[model samples]
Target: MHRRSFDRFNWQDVLREIPPSHIATRVSFFLAGFLMALWASLVPFVKSALGLDEGAFGAVLLSIGFGALVTMPLSGILIGRSGAKKVLAFAVPVASSLLVAAALVPAALPSTAAVVVILFCFGAFFGAIDVGMNIHSVVVEARSGRKLLSGFHALYSIGGVAGAGLMTLLQTAGLPGVGSACALSMLSAVVWLFAGRAMLPDAGRNAESDGHGGPKFVFPKGVVLFLGAVCFILFLVEGSILDWGALFLMDEKGAALEHAGMGFAIFSVAMTVMRFVGDRVIMSIGPKRTVVFGAAAAAFAFVLAVLSPNAWTAAAAFFLVGLGTANIVPIAFAATGEQKEMPMSLAMSAATTLGYAGLLTGPAAIGVLAEATSLSTAFLSEAVLLAAVAAAAALTSVFRKS
Candidate 1:
C-alpha cells in the first residue's frame, strides 16, 4: 500500500533530486514575500488608525518610500560586501524590528511626526529585505535552471492573501488595528528567524562581481531604461491595489467594512495562483506575449471595474488585474538579469530601486489624483498606465540586443 501510494507520486522523486537547500532558498524568498505582503496588508489599517485625509495620507506613505529609496541603492553594495546570508540575517531582524515599531507608533505617538518617523523606518527596512531577497532569489534560480522566479514571487502574493485574511479576521474579532499590526509584525520576524538557518549562504554572490565591474553603479541605459519603465508600470498597478483597492470597494462599491478586504484578497489569490503557473506560461507563451497580453487584459479588467454597475463585477475586475500583473514584474527581472551593459547584481538592484520607487510613489500619486478628481479617476489613470506597459512589451523585442 505504501509503495502504491509512493508510486502514484513520481513527481516527488524528481523533485527530490534537486538540492534541498534550493528549496529552502525558495522558502526564504517566500518569507520575504510575507514581509512585503504584511506591509501592503497594513496600508488600510494604517490609514484608518491615523484618520488621515488624502493629502496627509499620501505624504505619510511617501515617508516609507523615502526610506526604501535611501536603502535600495545600498542593497547591492551591502550584499556584495556581506553576502546574502549575512545581509539577510542582519537586515531581516532589523526590518522586522521596524515593522513592530511602526505598528506600535500609534501607541507611542499620535502626532503626525511620529507617524512619519515610523513609516520611514518601515520603508527603509522593507526595501533592504526586498532587494536582498530578490538578489537571493535570482541566484537560486540561476542555479536551478528552472523558471522558478515567477513562482517565488507568487509566494509573496500568497503572503498578501494570508496577511490580509489574518488582518480581516482580527479586525472582525474587534482587535484594535494597532494590536493586530504588532502581532503580525512580530510573527513575521519570528518566522524569518526560524527559517534563517535553513537559508542559502551564497544567495547574493553575484554582488561581488557587480561591485568590481567597470562602474559600481550605472544609470539605466537603452533597453534597461525601457525595462525599468515597464517595471514601474507594473509596480504601480500593485501599489494601487494595495493602497486603494479597499477604499474603492467601500467608497464606490459600498461594500461593508467586513467585506471590503475581499477586493485585495481576490487580487492576491489570482496573482499568487498565476505566478505558480507563470513559469510554465512564460515557457510556453514567451515573455513578450506574456507581458503584452497580460497588460492588455489587466487594463481591460480595471476598465470593467470602473464601468461595472455591480459589486460582483468590481470583484471580478480586481481578479483580472491580479492575473494580468502576476508575470510582468518577473519577466522584467529576468530581462534585467539578461542585460549585458551592467552586472546582473547591479542591474537587478537598480531595477529593484526603480520598481520600488514606483511602489513608494505610486500609491501617493493615486491619492493626489484622488484628491483632485476621484478614486475612479485615479483607477482610470492606472488603466492607462497598464495599457502603456502593454505597448512597451510589444516593442521590447527591438531592444533585445542591449
Candidate 2:
C-alpha cells in the first residue's frame, strides 16, 4: 500500500483526502492515550476498593502488561490477514468499554481475580488498537510524503495530558471514578465511530493477501531486530521516568511527596512540546541525525537528572530527558514500516512487541538494580544504555534517507 502511494502527493491530496485519513489515525492514538489516562486516574480508587497493598497492587499491574504482551504480536498478523481499518474499528470501541469496566469492577465485586480479568481484557484490546493505529499512521504518513508521524504522535502525548486533567476536573465537579471513566469512554466511542470511515481500507491488506504474504510472523532479524532493540532501550528510558521518577525526586532530590508528581508532569509537557516540533526537526535534519542527537541528549539528561543538587534542578533535567526522547519512537516506527526484511504489518508487530516488552520490564528492572545498588546507579545505567542507543543509531542502516 505504501510503496504504491508514495509516487506523489499534491495539495489536492493533502487538502481533499489527507485530512480524513490523518483524522482517522489520529483519533486512534488520542483515544488510546485518553482512555489510558482515565484508567491511571482511577488507580487509587481501584486499589482501595480491591483491598490490595502496594506489593499486591504491583503484582496486579503486571496483568495489564501480560495481556498487552500476549496480544500485541497477534495484532500485526490480524491486520495482515484482515486490515487495520477493521481491527481498529473493533479494538478502539472495545478498549474504551473495558476502561469503564476496569473502573466499575472494584465497586461491583472488589475481587482481585475480577479486577485482573477486566484489566487484562482492557490491555489486550488496547494493545491491538495501539499496533493497528501505528500501522495505519505509517501508511498515512508515507502516502502524504511528509513528516507527519511526529505530529500524529504529538496528539497521543497531548491526549495523555488532556485526559488526566480532564478526569481530575470531572472528579472535582463531583463525578466519581466510575462516572469519569464512563464520560471519557463515551467521548472515545464517538471518535471511533466517526473515524472508522476514513481509515485506509487496504492499508495492510494489499501487502498481506494470499500468494504475496510471508509467514505467520516475521522474525525481528538483522535491521528489524536492531531497530527493535533501539526502541526497547528508548522505551526503557521512558518507563523509568514514568515509574520511578517521582521516587527519585522524593528520596534522592529532597522533593515533597505532593511536589514530586510535578517531575512527570514537567517531563510530559516537555515531550509534548518537542513532539509538536519534531516533524519539522525530522524534516530538517532527517531521521539518522534526529535519533543520533536525540539519544545523546537524553543520555546527558539522565545523568544530570541523577546528579543535580536539588529536586527543581532534577525536574528540569527530566524535562530535557523527555524532550530528547520524544521523537525517537516515532522515528523508529517510520523506519520499520519501510523495511523489506518482512511484511510491513508483521515487522511493525515485532518492533512494537519488543518495545512494549521494555515497558513491561523497565520498572521492575530498575527496582532490582536499585535494590542491589542504588537509584542513582540504576539511572546512570540507563544513561549508559542511552549512549549505546545513540551509537547504534549512528552505525545502523535501519535509518534511511527520508
Candidate 3:
C-alpha cells in the first residue's frame, strides 16, 4: 500500500520525467501564494504611509476582499472562453506589477483613494489567478490520473513560508519596507515570466461545454453546492484561526501578546507539513476517509482548544486542527472536477467564491458573536460547524455511492 501510494508521487519521476504543463501548474500555485504573502507583509508600511487609524485601515483592507469578490465569479467564465493559461498569463503580470505599484504608493501619493483602487485591482487579479490556477491543476491531474492536487496545494504553502520569511529577513537586515517590497515584487514578476512559459495553452477549454457557447456562470448546485457549503465552513475555520486565535490565547489562556502569535504560527507550520504529506495519506485512505477522519480530528481539536486550561495546551490543539484539516479543499477540488453538475471551471469558480466569502466575513462574524457571548462560545460554535462539515463531506454525493 505504501509503495503504491509512493509510486503516485515518486520523487525521481517528478524531478526528471515531469511534463512542462505540470511544472507550469506548480509554479502558478507557488507564484500566487508568494505574491499574496508578499503584499501581506507590506500592509503595515502602507498603513503608516496612509496615516489611517485602525478602523480606517480595516476599511481599506476590505478593498482587497472586495476585489476578490468582484473578479472570482468572472474567472470561470473567462477561463471557459480563454483557457486557464491565457487567464493566468494575463492576470499574473497585472498582479505582480501591482505589488510594486502598491509599495510605491507611499512615495507617489499616499492617498487612501489610490491605495484602495490599486489594492482592489491587486486583489482582483489574485482572485482571478486563484480560480485559473486551480482549474489548471484539475485538468493536469485528470490527464495524469494521479493524486497530485494536494501536493500542488502544498507548493502554495511552501511559497507562502518563503515569501513571509524573505520579507522578515529583509526587515531584519534593516532594509526599508517599501524598497524591500518593490524589490521582492520585481523578483516575483521575473520568476513568473520564466515559470509561466510552460503552462498548457488549452487547459480548461474542453470541459463539458454544450457547444462553442461554453459554460455560463451558474450558482453552485448538486454536488457542487455541497462542496461550496463545505468550503464555506472550512474557510471560516481557517479565517477564524488566522484572525482570532491569537486573541483567544492572550485573553482566555493568559499568553503574552508577543507569544500569542505562536498559536497561529503553530497552525500554519503544521498545516504546511501535513499538506506535504496529504497526497500520500489520501492515497492510502482515500478521500472519504481522509475528509471524515480529518474533519473529525479538527473538530475535536477545536473542542480541546475551547477546554484547555492553559495557552500551551490550546496551541497544541490548534496544531492538531491544522494537521487534520490540511487537505480538505484539495480533495474538494478533485471531487468537483469529477462531478457532472456543471462545467469543471464554472463549478470551481462558484465553490471558490463562496469559500472566500466565508474567509472575508467569518472574522467579523466571530467578533460579533464574541461580543454578544464570549470568544470561547464563538469558538465552540465553529467546532459545531466543523463537525457539520465532516458530516456534510461524508454524506455528499461526491464521496457517497450514487
Candidate 3 per-residue C-alpha lDDT over 138-256 given as tens digits, one digit per residue, 9 for 90 to 100 = 88988887788888988898888888898899989998877887788788778778878888877777545433677677888888988888888889999999999999999999999
Provide the lDDT at 352 for model 2.
92
- lDDT tens digits by residue: candidate 2, 1-402: 786677665677676754788888887788788888888898998999998999999889889888988898888888988889989889888888888888887889889998899889888988898889899999999988899888888898878878998988888999786787787887888878987889998887645486346458667897788878988887888888888999999999999989988888888888889999999999899888998899999999989988899999999999999988899999999998998887888888888999999987987899999999999999999999989988988887667553
Give the least accurate 10-residue stretch of model 3, judged by summed lDDT: 393-402
lDDT of 1 by residue, 1-402 (tens): 999987788887888887765666666666666666567666776677678898888788789778888888777667765566777777777777777766666555657788788778777877777887787777677667777789888776666566767877888999876677667777776777766766677566564354344335567777677777888878888888977998998898888888888888799789988999998988887878888899999999999998888667898999999999898888888777777676666677788988887876788899999999999999999899999888877875832311
- Residue 35 displacement (Å), model 3: 0.8
Q: How many backbone clashes does candidate 1 have?
A: 0
Q: Please report the TM-score between candidate 3 and the true structure.
A: 0.93
Can you give the TM-score per candidate against the true fold? 0.80, 0.92, 0.93
The top-ranked prediction according to TM-score is 3
Off by over 4 Å in 1: 1-3, 6-18, 36-61, 103-118, 163-194, 197-202, 206-214, 246-261, 367-377, 398-402
Question: Whole-model Cα lDDT per candidate?
Answer: 0.77, 0.86, 0.87
Relative to the true structure, candidate 1 has a C-alpha RMSD (angstroms) of 4.2
